[model samples]
Target: MRSPKQDSAAFTQAPEAVFEAALGVLQNAGNMTLLAAHNGGRRLIARERPKMSNAKFLDIRVEGDAGAAQLHVTVGTDPRTPKAMLDGKANAKVLKNYVASVRGAVDESSPAPASPVADHCLQKKTEVPWADAGQDPEIELDGNIRAAYGL
Candidate 1:
């Protein structure tokens, strides 16, 4: 379930790069485990240490074009646990701290623009050797050979 407590920020970087920054921030936050990450979709889900008294989770979503990105973060507590109470003050503080940390980490570690060399590498294509080009690429063995080798 999505939390009502959410925050968002925009950056002058790619969505994928921002996603990586979010992962790093979560890791450094300690006790946060990445549950799911979709690089193509630019989304990440993480859970706080289950052992903690206040069990919580985070959902980070990224969207952007080639030049800019936006990150949305949602923080929520475990709905199944009856002990998890909704405290406005606590939730607000947690969300605030999380947003601040995420922003700081992204600003510090976001990937720089691709260099000319990197751009060239991304654009380049290589041709495979003719001998290996039209082959199955999988090794095939005869049943007799397998049996002889101890099938």
Candidate 2:
């Protein structure tokens, strides 16, 4: 019978499975887009099953209307690459703050514009109208994130 460590080693050797799991995590979270996984990581898309190792890490970026954010999930060795796991702790603390911002915005009233632009300008900001109140400056995690060097 294979030892537990041996079993783990065999599992880690399966890079395709790791990649799929990582992708599943992101897809479950919410808004996310799958860019590409190729280059030294190239031609990866062509292969039906792209294999990776502990030395290889997958970088995923989520793009929103405002900007983008990156999540680097490791294959093989590092299991803490999932965004929810990596950012969950911080998000847990911060999510309350986010809810508060939304609440405050919903409660506050905006001043009446001198010009209604009603059916005139043809361009009215209905979505995120209250987003300018300094509540949350659009959480653009990917564009603002940088991998820790030497990690």
Candidate 3:
């Protein structure tokens, strides 16, 4: 059997909060279907939508308290058939992008430390969305959950 690809990262937020952010990030990435959500335990199991990919599933687990949290993510591909296996590079890219999105969400939720005027200006300029007038901001996550999560 092939081993699943795995990655972990620590976050300076409550485990529950980080779990919630992760759910949002996964849903936003599109074509992910939640298979199980253990809210009390801060764990979720999901998979790429059938139409999107047939072989990949994701397991996300969180642990820690209000002061700190750790997230463990694993990407597994079905081993019943050799052709269904996912490549290491693809799995690593998925994990990296997911972690970055979750981190960004956490950062956006918390207030940043005070910085110089010029620094703040530059940061805002890069992060701000300059959507066209009268057009809605891009929706990264699809479906009703996007509204429920306020993403």
Candidate 4:
């Protein structure tokens, strides 16, 4: 494990170099959906989570050698609709190839660097008041039930 200071330095330096290498690794993976990726060195570890559904979720992790990296990605399907996979018109084998192509693009190595200006940006916190949910009361009373209860 690296100290905080060491990690910070690794992240601040050339991050893209590592990612490019990892991209090479993923490009060779046979059949898998590109879920997420990670990249770093002795000092830092950067990871990215894939988007979910039309909005879904992708889980991924990577473990790299002192100079290399490893990755774990989980692919899921959407119940509401099939993504990437179309109707019968789409070939099943072609769909598999398509997913492989995307997985190849994922590089579990160095990630994109943060903008220097981001370090200087100030963040503000705000407090919000909570309100109770109001309930609606609009229903016709049953004459028979009302009569039974003499209401």
Candidate 5:
């Protein structure tokens, strides 16, 4: 029997938002289906049943109110599934991928206006004096390395 794998993460968005994003990411993932969703997206259950592969289960739960949330996730093969049918640590790997996908999904939907920090990155960089003048700034004015280094 394969043991369950679990992980959790925190996000800046609301619980509902994070839950929905996770659900969407799972939906886009191949061979996964939504088994159920309850608590207005605060709790969800999904299954991964690939052809000729071990079936896996996923559970996601979200907590917190507005503007802040925590997401908990679990992945595992069915207990009844025989050991021979189990794939080693596949659940853990899948859980890691799921968490990464959910993180990307939650963070992808940015607010309309760019934050100041992000806007700063989009601005053109200032030119350096040495590069603009095509000069080797590392060398001394007279190209004397010993004098520059006080050697």
Candidate 6:
């Protein structure tokens, strides 16, 4: 049985910024959608754009606060995807790009904004259109993502 990929990173950037960078990558992916954002926007889940490729999803969790963050990402194959589907190194490539983008590899990081500005930016980014979810069938799990964690 094929399994999804998993990767994680610790960041000095604010949790909000790291999460936003991740959000940026997925938004521009053109083949993914925001599936869920919960725990005060500290966690997110997104699935591949429908009919685009093998049914896959990204589950991201940010642990920490303003001073630092640890990001955990899980790229999973949907139950609907076939077991015989050989993904080659596609998962590796995706993991690399996603981490780079979230870690600001592709974009320069300016000093964080001032308190008021930062608050505004945080509010804006966390208020995604699809999240509470984009278009995945598991849309109902939007905010309750950490049920296993017993949050």
TM-score of each: 0.62, 0.22, 0.63, 0.24, 0.64, 0.63
Colliding pairs, model 3: 28-141
User: How well is each residue in 89-117 modelled by candidate 6, as lDDT tens digits?
Assistant: 55556666678777663245522221211
- Write one digit per residue (lDDT tens) for candidate 5, span 1-151: 2577789999999886787787677667778865545544366656687676577777778888898999998887754455543564788878888888888787784212211111010012221222211211222222333232221
- lDDT tens per residue, model 1, 113-140: 3211110000012222222222211111
- Predicted structure with the largest lDDT when compared to the true one: 5
Backbone clash tally (model 4): 11
CA lDDT for candidate 1? 0.55
Q: How close is candidate 5 to the true structure, as a TM-score?
A: 0.64
Q: Write the per-residue lDDT of candidate 4 for residues 1-151, one digit (tens) a residue.
A: 0001111012221334334433443444343222222232211112122243122222223344445444333323222334453322223333343234333343333332321111010112221221211211111122222122111
Query: In what order do the candidates fall by TM-score, top score first?
Result: 5, 6, 3, 1, 4, 2
- The residue-level lDDT of candidate 6 at 83 comes to 50
Candidate 6 residue pairs in backbone clash: 34-134, 35-133, 130-133
- Backbone clashes, each candidate: 0, 6, 1, 11, 0, 3
Q: Which of the two candidates, 2 or 3, achieves a greater TM-score against the reference? A: 3
User: Of the candidates numbered 2 and 5, which has the greater TM-score value?
Assistant: 5
Model 2 C-alpha lDDT per residue in residues 36-85, reported as the tens digit of each score: 33211211110011132111122322212213222232222122233332
Candidate 6: list runs displaced more than 4 Å.
39-41, 49-53, 105-151
